[model samples]
Target: MPEITYLEGIRLGLQRLMRERPEVVLYGEDVGAFGGAFKVTLGLQEEFGKDRVFDTPISESAILGSAVGMATQGLRPVVELQFVDFGMTAVHHLLNNAATTHYRTGIPVPMTVRAPCGGGFGGGPFHSEELESLFCLMPGLKVVYPAFPSDARGLIYSSVMDPNPVVFLENKYLYRHVKEIVPQSFEPVPLGAARVCRAGRDAVVLTYGAMVHEALRAAEQLASDGGYEVMVVDLRTLKPYDADTVLTAVAATNRVLIAHEGWRTNGFGAELSALVADRAFHLLDAPVRRVAAPDVPVPFAPELENAYRPNADKIATALLELMEY
Candidate 1:
């Protein structure tokens, strides 16, 4: 058991997996010699050599196309998109080919495509985008977004071992900022599962990624200064979400607040809101509130960017409004 940052934990997990499975290989634009844009694969090339840990061309579609073929042929290929925003070029390959392969031919597409996502890095529009909503709509894809370091490591390992295609989104903001102790024998946290980060009986904040920190901060402020108790539930996986855990939390709290980094309209938050309204309608005392980025591209300016994305203050204000309602 060792305390590690989210980035370190993922690095450790990937390193371990590479050792355990000879068939497992990693490829991205700069993963080999450059060690990845975020350094997640730092030193991987030196350890595994360029034959296994190599770099791909700039085209995302090619990277995915190569991975899909390799994975279907019994090789575990972990391909990294430099950023989530860049994944648009490979939509046809991912949404249609990789996602539907299992149903199309009854064959498993055991591939893990990792994308560094979210804002707060001054990465502007092209580099920062929560692109989960696009693929969540596509059937046969396992979309996972982990908020904590341990979850990130465990889920990525599980994704590598899964028989179906998995899209692993890593929050760029949490990569270096968040850290936690990982068990030496870290068991994979089941997919479609949610973690109750904090428990409260008054109101609930359902969220993931960097917003998980924001929601917890908001909850703490509410308890200390506002005297309002707020429960925090981290939806670790977006698609195949743990409705049971969410409903249970909603039943106890009677109020819900959905949060994410994506735009407010037609975003993942809407999906979550619908689920709670449909399944836990009778248990709620107030309408489900959503705290998300504005319906606009991520801005390059610091001040404008701050307003574009959701944060602790915004979440706290929204929770207070829900409490009053």
Candidate 2:
């Protein structure tokens, strides 16, 4: 095992997959020569060649449309949207075409759309955003949001191999900052599974992506300073989120706090809260609380950006209040 940044792990996984499968083709803006805006695809163009690894125009809709056509024609295309915010420009292809092709025609579109998501880099409204909830609403889509370097590598590999149109949401905020030692061998984590990052008996924190790290931090602070045990649940896959694992933790902890980088209203956190209330209401000692971004566009100012994103301190404060209630 070697310590690697989250982006490096993804690069390794893609490289391994491309070597293993000839059908795997990657295309996106600056993916070839520039190695992507975040350098996740650095050195890939030289290895895979221009035919297999190429650049695309600046249209997100065109990129997604091309992926759909390629997938249907027997090519496993991995399309990258430079930023998640640009996904709005191609909502039709994502919502109607990529997501419904399987249901409408009984064909497996083995394609992946990887996009840099979340706020923290002061990327402002146009560059940073989380649109997982938008695609999660579609029945045939698989949504993956991984927090750690190892999980990011594993989940992205799985998404590339999956039969459905999977949206791999990479928290750009974690790309260079989050580090972990990953095994050389690439393993694919199955979709719809949740991992309990930390165990506790007082309260449970249901979260995913970069928020998982924040939740773990809050759990640590709660134990060290507040004497509260916070169970941290990381839902690696958002679309078919692990309900059983979530309920089990909620039952044991009795209190739940759902957290994510997405907005509070109609966000993934709200959906998780609904899932807990629907199936595990009897086990809850207190009402489920959601910690998420404020309902507004991401701000360009550094201070406002910090206020918009949920952090360890905010998560810890919410957990403490929920425990008291």
Candidate 3:
């Protein structure tokens, strides 16, 4: 009902959830007073007050550790990492404590770590990385990475409301760059569901976050020029990924391509490939292909970073290979 940027969607979701639920609190560096690094929380502090929306110290470990404590004590805390790469600082808290809290005991840790991820603006190695799989692989965590502005709003609402630790990956590339008409309501987009962004039959491309746009572009070009109808499947939630949807696509297309901006080696694409191979191998007319960033750190220079990340061109090339295979 309203056109908004990805960042605005996040802000709207936070605003709606905070208004509905008093237990929802936001904590991150410069979140209060300063209003976050990207100003997603610009007016949150003013609306919710400093107690409910406050800034945290520089240490990510401390931010998450405190969130764990608050969550165990019945507060629904939503913490933010300025960048996803910095999440490594609190890996112990994410991987061990926040993750295992409910599984080990009966107490639910309703907390969320919102991390802005991906790089198309030269954030370099220190700031750019898509560690979705890194967190999705962890059993006790729910990892959500939405590509569209509307899904960004819906998923953020769902993640914050869930009674478990959720890693909400916000693509920096999509934050201000992408915009669309979003729903007026704050309905939650259920996690663990796959969205078929485009319908096709020749091949299927499985991806999420910013890469989902690339896959759609590739699908368009493939249809226009190559006459190859490529179905684009967006795995909105990575942790409890939609396996049935993915396998159905693989079975129908008989050709699949897994793409992401993360490093090719051990990237989330690998998991999708494995799933297809294991479950839908008989239906595959060609081997499952993958298009991902090379095994290297995100570069500082724009030109190098452009090459470092996967793009629509690369995705189309991979699709052609899979289609012709």
Candidate 4:
């Protein structure tokens, strides 16, 4: 119906959920009157009031612990960590408690932890970490990272309504950098589904979050520069990732390049590589390649940060290498 930024899409989804569901309550650091660090939650407190949309203390553990308790009860708590990097402090609550509640007992922890992640701005190490792999490691947690505004809006609705714990990763870079016209009324985008953003036959780029955009750009560049048609598959959900779609893409395009903004070692792309190697190795024309940030902290300097993050150039280079292989 209208063009909206990625940040606005998430806000609209949250607003609609609060309006429709009485049990959904949102709280986080300075998320109330002060809005959020990125202002994604701006004006929400005024609309929902303090009880439903309030602020919490400066403890990630306390915030997550309370959410886990509230979720086990009847309430669906949507908590926000100012940055995904801060979520490391409360991993115990997620890994040990929230993730184990249903197995330990019969209770479901329907909680959504909205984490702003990735590096493009000079947010230094603390603010720009991509920790999707960490959340994916948790057995009971579902990880959703949307690259487009429409997907961001729809996934937020589904994540909130889910019975299990969900880690909703909002790439800080995409918050304003990406925008698209989406219908005002939309359906929830099903989790564990991957979208083929671009179609090709020579090579395929498997990525998620901000890297999805980078992969698309790389695909475009390759099509014009080297007459290579590169496919780009966006793994919208990491935990219950769409294996069938991934294998299909790999089968169609005999070469694969897995890209992400996280570290090269043990990142989410590593899992995708393993999946291809394990299930679709016979279908590949080249070894699975990956383009990711080095195993180093996100830098504060703009130049270093730019180099630290994977971009279209990096992905295209890797794609060319895969094509030649």
Candidate 5:
């Protein structure tokens, strides 16, 4: 086993998908010889050729519209957006066309949109936005966000294989910041599953993506600082999230705290909070809390970005409030 970063894991998965499935194709802006804005697709064009792996123009709407067409014609097209924030320009293709294709025309749109999201390095507003909730609200799109390298590798395979539109969000900050030793090969992680990364009885933090790692750090800090054991649940898939696992964690812990890097108002955390309130209202020992970015654009200055982003310290403080409540 070799230790690989989160970005490498995604690339490995893309490589495997292209090699195993000849019908699979990858294209995006600057994704060819340029290797993508973050170099996640470096050397893929040479190995897979310009036909299967190539670059496209700056028009996201045109890129996604073509992908929807390709998917209907029996091609698995993986399109990447330089940043998830830019996706708003062409969301109608995803919402009206790709999402409603199957129900309207009985044709499956098996296209995967790879989007780099989140902010920790001062990408400002245009480059650093967490819009998972916006995608999740669409009826026909499946949203997947991986917190670990192993999960990133496995989920990409599953996302590409699924016979529907999938939004695969990659946390930009975690590309090189997180690493793990994974097997040379592994099984595909099923969509809509949640993993309990840490066990505890006091409280549980419901989160995903980069926040999962922060929740783990907060759990450790709480364990040492207050002798409080905090549980952390990573909701790997957002749309068809693992409700059973979440309810179970809430039942066992009796306290819940939702953490995310997105805006607190109407963010994905609100959905999770609603789920707990609806089904497991009686199981709570305290009011469900949230630690998320305030409702504002992501700041450009490093200091401002640091305050704008939800971190381990914020999570820890929220956990303490939940525990004390």
Candidate 6:
């Protein structure tokens, strides 16, 4: 199989789906003629035409409201918010209308909101923020964040096919940088599945999205320098996270480290930490460690941002402490 960029893998999946499923439509700002801000939808407008794939106004609320309305009418809309940060602007429509429509009317509001997230590559405050925990907290929303190119391609298709509202978080940093041999025929990597990227026995690191690579780096460093085997868990989905996988990894390793690019306080790591504490506390040999960005606004300065973000060195440092404890 030929290798494809992570961004191209997403385009391939959407292109195949749009061609195969007439009900699938693309809606977002600059998605049609402009091919999206990141150019992930480039040339799609020409193939799918303006009707099936088109742009929308700058209002996130309007984009979400329109998707919900279309989903009810039996259209599976793939909505895009340019940046995850702007998703906050449309919280009302997403959390209240689309998320709760099924429970109120017993209907499947099948739609997926795609947004580029994470803070590496100096995207700054507005373009950088990771809001996984915010949507993960909502009862009706299913959040899926994939790290690898294969996962990126597969999860996008599954999210479109899902019955409820799904927030498909794409890391901007992984868009062009990451590449893998995605199968020629797209396959759906089911939601709520946990992939163990690298297996180990001394410690388990639970992570997703852009942070998965960082966690892997930490695992390598610990294994090479510290002589400690580390288990790295890539949570492809967030809201319906794989607790069974997490417990198993924690049980075998006896040490846990949860990390993410999102802020530490009230971040998704906090939720994962609490889950392990509640159910797998007895299996832990040390207090679960969390490595995350400080609870502050994302900075524009590259140097400051580097310090603000948690990377391999930082994660390894925390893991070493956990190993000692």
Candidate with maximal lDDT: 5
Residue-wise C-alpha lDDT for candidate 4, range 1-325, written one tens digit per residue: 7999999999999999999999999999999988889999899999999989999989999999999999988999999999999989988999999999998898999999999999898899999999999899989999999999999999999999999999999999999999999887999999899999999999989999999998999999999999999999999999899999999999999899999999989999889999999999899889999999999988999889988999999999999899988
What TM-score goes with each of the models? Answer: 0.98, 0.98, 0.98, 0.99, 0.99, 0.98
* Order of models, best lDDT first: 5, 4, 3, 6, 1, 2
Q: Estimate candidate 5's RMSD in Å.
A: 0.6
lDDT against the true structure, per candidate, is 0.91, 0.90, 0.92, 0.94, 0.95, 0.91
Candidate 1 runs further than 4 Å off = none
Q: For residue 87, give model 1's deviation from the true position in Å.
A: 1.0
User: For model 2, how does the per-residue alpha-carbon lDDT over 275-303 read when each residue is reduced to its tens digit?
Assistant: 88789889888999999999999898999
User: Residue 278's C-alpha lDDT in candidate 6?
Assistant: 98
lDDT of 3: 0.92
Number of colliding residue pairs in each model: 0, 0, 0, 0, 0, 0
Clashing pairs in 4: none
Q: After superposition, how far is residue 98 of candidate 5 from its true place, in Å?
A: 0.3
Give the per-residue lDDT digits (tens) of candidate 1, residues 83-106: 989989888998889998989899
Q: After superposition, how far is residue 187 of candidate 6 from its true place, in Å?
A: 2.0
Candidate 1, residue 228: CA error in Å?
2.0
* Cα lDDT tens digits for candidate 5, 1-325: 9999999999999999999999999999999988999999999999999999888889999999999999999999999999999889999999999999999999999999999999998789899999999999999999999999999999999999999999999999999999999999889999999999999999999999999999999999999999998999999999799999999999999999999999999999999999999999999989999999999989999999998999999999889888888
> On a 0 to 1 TM-score scale, where does candidate 4 land against the true structure?
0.99
Consecutive 10-residue window with the lowest summed lDDT within model 4: 33-42
Point out the higher-scoring one by lDDT: 4 or 5.
5
lDDT of 3 by residue, 239-314 (tens): 9899999998988888889999999888899998888878888998988889999999889899999889999999
Clashing pairs in 2: none
Question: CA shift at 272, candidate 3, in angstroms?
Answer: 0.8
